[model samples]
Target: MPKTYYGKYGIEVRTNEHNHKGQKAHVHVYIHGVEVGAFFLDGQLMVGNVKRKDRIAIEQLILSNRDEFQAMWDEFQKSAY
Candidate 1:
């Protein structure tokens, strides 16, 4: 997993190739240690567990760095095998 960005409020965003079964290439957001949510690299929330107060910032973070995250995912997959 590569951390793509970090923000205030202890928010961190990361992308990983080895998510649970059935998950797509996605970004995971964490606050403290708990996973706040999982989102597609395109910035769409695949499953919303994100804290309400942090949703906007997280979304913006994803949207702003979608391409970089996607690239990281692609590279990770290529190197994985």
Candidate 2:
């Protein structure tokens, strides 16, 4: 997992590359080492639970840096192979 964004109050956004069979591009949101949510590049939540304020912050972060995050995901996929 690579740390992508660090925000106020210990919030973080990171990308995880699945090194095994059947994995898709996604990001993980964390607050103080605890995962709050996992979301796709398109800002769709895949799993985990997040508070409303945190959810909005995560979505906004993704939206603002969508292209960069997508590119990172692509690079990570290539590297995993």
The local distance difference test score of each candidate is: 0.62, 0.65
Candidate 1: the clashing residue pairs are none
Quote model 1's TM-score.
0.69
Model 1, span 1-81: residue lDDT tens: 445446442323333335443446777777765676777766677775766668777778777877777776666655533
TM-score of each: 0.69, 0.73
Q: Note the clash tally of each candidate.
A: 0, 0
Cα error, residue 40 of model 1, in Å, equals 0.9
Model 1 stretches with alpha carbons more than 4 Å out: 9-17, 20-23
Instruction: Please give, for residues 1-81, the per-residue lDDT of candidate 2 as tens digits.
Output: 557546542323333334442467667677766767688777777788888887777777777777877777766666634
Per-candidate Cα RMSD to the true structure, in Å, reads 3.3, 3.0
